[model samples]
Target chain A: MTPSSGASARTQPLDHKEIVAAPRTLVLVGNPNVGKSVLFGALTGKYVTVSNYPGTTVEVTRGAAEIGGLRWHVLDTPGTNNLLPMSEDEQVTRDILLREPEYVCLQVCDAKNLRRGLLLACQLAEAGVPFTLALNMADEAAARGIRIDTDRLSGALGIDVVSTVAVQRTGLPLLLERIPEAGVSKFRPRYDAAIESALSELEPLLPAARLSRRSLGLMVLAGDDSLQPWLASGASAVRLERIEGIRRALASRYPESLRFVVARQRLAAADRLHDQVVTRGKASAGSALARRIGAWSTDPVKGIPVLLLVLAAAYLFVGVFGAKTLVDFLENTVFYDHVVPWTEAFLRFVVPAGAVQEFLVGPPGLPFRETSGFVIGKYGLVSMGLAYGMAIVLPIVATFFLSFSVLEDSGYLPRLAVMVNRVFKWMGLNGKAVLPMVLGLGCDTMATMTARIMETRKERVIVTLLLALAVPCSAQIAVIFAMLQGLSFAASLWFSAVIVLVLFLVGWLAARVIPGRGSDFVLELPPLRVPQLGNVLVKTLARMEWYLREALPLFVLGTLLLWVLDRTHMLGLVERAAAPVVVGILQLPEQSASAFILGFLRRDYAAAGLFQIYQPYMSTGTMTRVMEIQVTVALVTVTLFIPCIANFLMILKERGWKTGLAISAFVLPFAVGVGAAVNLLMRRFY
Target chain B: MPALVQRQERCPLCGMAFDAEGQGCRPSCPLATGCRVVCCPSCGYSFPQESGWAGKLKGWLDRRKEAGR
Candidate 1:
C-alpha cells in the first residue's frame, strides 16, 4: 500500500502532491545523551547535515534509509525530556509529532536510565503515536548492573521493544524488522480527578491533529504556551476562551499550578512503571564513588564546608590572580607603558594637534584642559574604555566564567541551591530563588527576567529588590576586588559583612511586608561528574565575547559623557551641587561625585572610576588609615547603588512600573543611608 | 550550499535546553533588536549565545574527539 493511502487525515487537509513526493518518515525521539545519534547513524547508514525546521531555529536531521524494502526518511529530533514542551527544542519536537502527516517514531532509551526514558515513552504512548522502543546502550546498562525485562515492558505498553548497543550494531536487524509492525500503544497515565475532568472538557474544544485530542488537551492543561499557534490555527476564539476557562477552573482547585500537578502525576506513573519492569544491582566502583561525593556535596552539614572551600578557591583565582596580577600586568605594563604611548603618538602624527587629536587621547596637559580625549587621550576611547574593558574587566570575568562553567558542568549548582534552601526560606522564597540570585552575579538584567521562575510575586519582588540593592554583577565585583586588594583583610571582610547584612535585613523585612506566601522547593539534581574541558572553554569564551561586545561600548560611552561634561564645566557644577553628600556626609572628595553620577549609567563604570581615583593613593604609598576606610565606604556604596539602565528597564517590564519604581526609590536612599552610617561608625572605631 | 542550522544552548542554572536562535525575549523589549543572549523559555534564564568562530571551534573539537574515539 502507498504511504499516503494509510496516512490519517483527521487533522488538516493533506497536501496530495507533497504526500506522494515525500518518503515515509521514521522519527527518533529520546532524552539527551541517550545514544539517539548513534542509533540514527546505524539506521540511516550515514550522518546527514541538519537543517532548521520551518519557522524555527531548531535543527532536525533527515536522512534516507531503506527499511523493510521501503524508502524511509529518518528524522533525528532534538532530545527532549518531555513532550509538554518546556523549551523551544521540546516544542519543535512535539510539533513534528503533531504535524507530520505519516510517520512512525523510534523511541530510543538508555538502558541504564530507564525511568527518564519511560517518562518520554509515556507521553508518546498518550499521544497515540505509532512507535517501536529501542533500548540503546544495553552493554553499558549491563556493565552498571541494571537489567530491564524487555518482554514485560513490551507486553505492558503493547509495543515492540528491542535491546541494542547501537555502537556495536547489536539487534539492528530485529529493530529494522519491527519498524513495519509499529503500532500505537494503548498506554495512558491516569491523572487526578481535577486534571481528568479538565482534559475531558478541553478535548472537545481542541482541533484534530496527528496527536490524539486527549494529548493536546493535556498540553493545554499544562499551560504550554508554545502550543498557541497550533491551537489557534483553525480553532475559534470562543472555543479557545472556553478551553482557557476550563484550565483556569482546574488550576484554581489546587494551590500549585496545573503544570506542576500534571508533571508530578506523569513522573509518579513513570516511577511505578519503572519499578515493575526493572531491577538494579550494585553499580560500578567509579560511579558509586561519584554518587557518594554528590550526596556529600548536598548534605546540609558537609556541604557548608564544601561551599566555603569553593568560595575561597574562587577568591584566590578570580580576586588575587585575575584582578590584581592580570590587571597590573595588562594595565600598567602593556597599556600605560606601550599601547597608550604608541597610540597617542600615532594619533598626534596622523591628525592635527588640536581638537581631534585632543579628543583622541586626552588634552596635552595632565590636570585640567578645555579639550576632551577621544581615542588615546585622557578620556580616550582606546586608553580608558578599551583598557578597562580588556585589561581590567576581561581577565576577571573570564576567570569567573571559567569557574562558573566548571561548577555548572560538574553539576554542583543544584547542590549549592539545595544547601541554601533554608536561608532562602527566611526571605519568603524557596531554594529556586537561588538560581536567579546566583545568576545576578553574572548579570542583573538577565537575572531579573529569570525571576519569572519564582512561584509567587512576593518572592520575585524580594529577589529583585535584593539583586538591585546588594548583589553586585561580576564586573563590579571584580572592580571591588581590585579596589580592596590594597587594604587589610579586615577591609575586605567589612565590605562583605556590610553587603551580607543588608541583604538579610532587607530580605527579612520584605517577607513580612510583602502580601503573598512562598511555595515549597522541589528541584531535580543531576548526577555530578567531572567538568568537561571543552565545554568550560566554550562557555568562558562565549561570555568573554559578550562582555566585549555588549559592555565595552557602554564603557566608552560613559567615559565620553564624563569628558563632555568636564569640557562644558558641567561635571564640576554637578559635583559642587552634590558636595553636601559627597564631601560633607560621606567625606569623599568632590571628584568622587563623578563616580556616583556614572554609577547610575553602569555600576562597573562607577567602580572603575573609583578604582582610577584610588590608584594614586595606593601607588604614592602615602595611604593613611582614613584613606583605607574611605575605600571600603566607596566600594560598599557603589555595590548597593541603583541597578544599571538595562536592569532597571527589565525590572519595569517584569515587575510592573509601580513595583519597579518603588524598588529603585527604596534602594537609592537606603544605600546612601547605610553608606553614611558605615562611614561614621568605622571612622570612630578605627 | 551550506546547511542553515542554529546552535543549541542549555541554561546552566535550570538545565533547560533550547535553540540558540529561538525563544528570544519579546520584540517590544528594547534589547530585543540586537540581543545576542539566549533566554530560556522554561525559566527565563539568559546566557550569551556562542559566536560563530566559537561555534566552529567547538564543532571542530567535537569532530576531532569523535575521530579519536
Candidate 2:
C-alpha cells in the first residue's frame, strides 16, 4: 500500500504588515490533510518544517504567527478524525489539548470533507475548548458544491465561524476579525440526562482548574483517570458512589458503553447543528474509482493477488532497480572513480608511515580486494560505509520509502489491515496488531515503537517478538533478494516456504507466552487517493535522511568496533565460544563466522559482507551453504542481535531497560532453537 | 483496584466459546455485537452488567477481609 502523503497545498511567505504585536495562540485542528500546514505557514510567516512526533510513529509541526494584532503560537496538530484518538499522532493532538492554554483553536474543516472533520470538532466542543470553525478548502467545496451558511453555522454552534481556502489565503481577513472575539467563548458539550445529572452533583464539589467545570465534572463522571493527579485522594471513591447512584437511578437507560453514550450525546447535537447550517450537494472524496480499488485490495477474492503484486513490487524495486541499478552507478562510478583512490593517495601523502597509511587507506594484504573485510579499518570503513550508505542501503531504502509513501497516500493500507485481521486472530493476536506487523516489513525499529498503539502489554510484547524474529528490514531484504537472484526457482521457492512457516509458527508460539484479549481494531479508513509524487518525494527524502543518519554511523562504527575486537582477539574468543551453536546448530562452515560477528553490528551490512564471500567463489555445495547461512543469519540476527542503536534508545524511553532487555533475552535462544530445527531438517532432506 | 468479570460462561474477550466445564453458571451480555470481545485484561471492560453488582459485592467482602472479619 502506497502511503498517502496527502496533498500539502501551496504556501506564500508572510509580510511585515501582517505581523501583530500582542501575543496570542491559534491552534489548527482537523482531520488529515485539509491543508492545515498551508494555512499555518500563511498565518505565522514561519517556515514550518514537517517532521514526526518524538518517541512514536507520528509527526506534528508547531510555529509562530500574527493574527488580529496578536502574535500567535500556531501549531499544526496531527490529523485526528474523531474524539477517540487511535494512532500515536492522534494521541499527541489530544495530549496538546489536555494542556490548557490561552489560545484560540481553529478547527479547520475541508468544505468538501466536513463530515469527517466535524467528528473531531465535536470532540473539541465536548472538551469545551474555545475554538473557531475554519471551513478550509473553500475552492474544493465550491467545486463539490458544498454551500455552508457561516452565520447559521456560528449561530447553531454558538461560536465564531468562517470559510477559507487556507491554501489560497482566501479567508484570513474574516478569520482574523473573529480571532480576538474568540478569546473567552465557551463550547458546552451536551451530555445525556443521567451523566449531566451526575455532573451537576459533582461540579460544586470539584475544585477549579484550566478545563471547564462541566468538562471536569463530566470527566470525573466518565472516569478519565488522566485527571487523577488534580483530584483529591478519595476522589475516585466519592466519584464512584455518585456515578453508581446515577446509574442505579438511570437503570441501563443509555447504551452499554459510557464512551458511546458520551459520543452519541455530542454527535446528536453536532448533527442537529450540521443539518441547520450545511447542505451537501455531492460526495467529493469517495468516488466510484476508490470503491473499486478499495474492494479489490481488502476482500479475499482479489486481495490475495493484490497483496502478491505489492510484495513483487517491493522485490523488483529494491532488488532489480535499487541494488542492481543505483548501487552499481554509485559503487562503480562515484566511489571507485573518485573517493577511494583519492582517499588512499591523501592518506599516503599525510600519514607517511606504511602501517598507518594502510590503516587509513588500504587493508593489509596481497590481492587488495581479499583484504577488504569487516575487521581491517580502512577496507571495513570504506566498503561497509560507502556500500551501506550510498550503494546498497540507500536506493533500496529510497524505493522502500517511496513505495510506503505511495501506499500511505493511496489509503489502501487500512484495507490490508482489515484483511489480515482474520489470520492474525488465528495466531492469538487480534487484527488490530496486524498494522505494526505489516509496517514491521518496512523497518523493525519503527514497528517496535508503533506497538504502543496496541491496548495491552501482552499484545505489544507479542508483536515486538514477532517483528524481531520474522520480519526482515528492507535493507537486509535487498541483499537477500540480490544474492538469491541467480538461484533456481525451486530453491528460491523452498527458501520462501521456510520463512512463511516460521512466521506463522513463531507468532503462534509467542502468542501463547503472552496471551490476552487483543484490542478491537475499529479503525477510520480514509478514502484512497492517487499518491502525489510531490508528497512521495518529500516523505521519502525525510525518511531516507533519517535512515541515513541512523544507520551510516552504526555501519562505520560497527566496522571500527569489530576492528578493535579483532585486534584484541575478543571476537575470536567469543566466536570460539559460540562455535558449537553457530556450527553444530546451524551446520555451516567456520568461515561464515565473520558474517555472524557482523550481524550484531548491522543486519543488511552484515549480509552484504557475507555475500561477497560466496558470490565470487560460487559452487554447488555453496548454494546449500548460502541458503543455510542466509536463513540462520536472517532469523537469529533479526531476533537476537542487539537492536541497532536507534531502537535501543526508544526501548529504554518507552518500556524501560528491564522489559527491553527481557525481549532481547527471549529472542536469542528462541531464534537459535528455530534455526537448529530448520538446519537439521534441511540437511536431512538433502 | 482491578475491575470485575461478570461473565461466568464463555469469555468473549478471550475468543473462547462456551466450555464443557462451565463453572455451573451462565454469563451473557445482550449488548455485545458478537460472541467475540476485546475485554480489557486489567479493567474487565468485557464483563456483563452483573460485574457492576459483583464489583460492589467484592469491594464489601474485601473490606471485611482486610479488617479480619
Q: Which has the greatest lDDT? A: 1
Per-residue lDDT over A1-686 for candidate 1, one digit per residue giving the tens place of the 0 to 100 score: 12221211123322334323447889899987667888887776643546788889998887666676666677899988789875678888998998889999999987877877898999999999999999988997786578899999999899999998988978777888887799999889999887887788789889989999998898888788888988898699999899989988898897656765787688779877987898767433365577678778877798888889888988888888888898889988998888877777777788887766666766665521123476765566777778887888788878877888788778888788777877888888867788778777877776787787785789899999999999998788778877776777887788899999999999999999989877655455555777778888887787666555557767878878887888899999999998999788888988989989989988888888887788877777777888888888888888898658778887888798999999999988888888898899889876
TM-score on alpha carbons, each prediction:
0.68, 0.58
lDDT of 2 at A163: 82
What's the i-RMS for candidate 2 in angstroms? 21.6
How many clashes show up in model 1?
11
Maximum-TM-score candidate: 1
Please give the TM-score that candidate 2 achieves against the real structure. 0.58
Per-candidate interface DockQ score: 0.31, 0.01
Each model's lDDT comes to 0.78, 0.60
- Chain A of candidate 1: what's the TM-score? 0.66
Q: Looking at model 1 chain A, which ten-residue stretch has the lowest summed lDDT?
A: A1-10
- Model number with the top DockQ: 1
**Worst window of 10 by summed lDDT in candidate 1 chain B:** B1-10
* Alpha-carbon runs more than 4 Å astray in model 1: A1-285, A363-372, B1-22, B32-34, B40-44, B66-69
Candidate 2, residues A205-286, lDDT tens digits: the string is 6666655666656555544444565565435667656655664454466422354356556655655566566665544355
RMSD in Å for model 1? 9.6
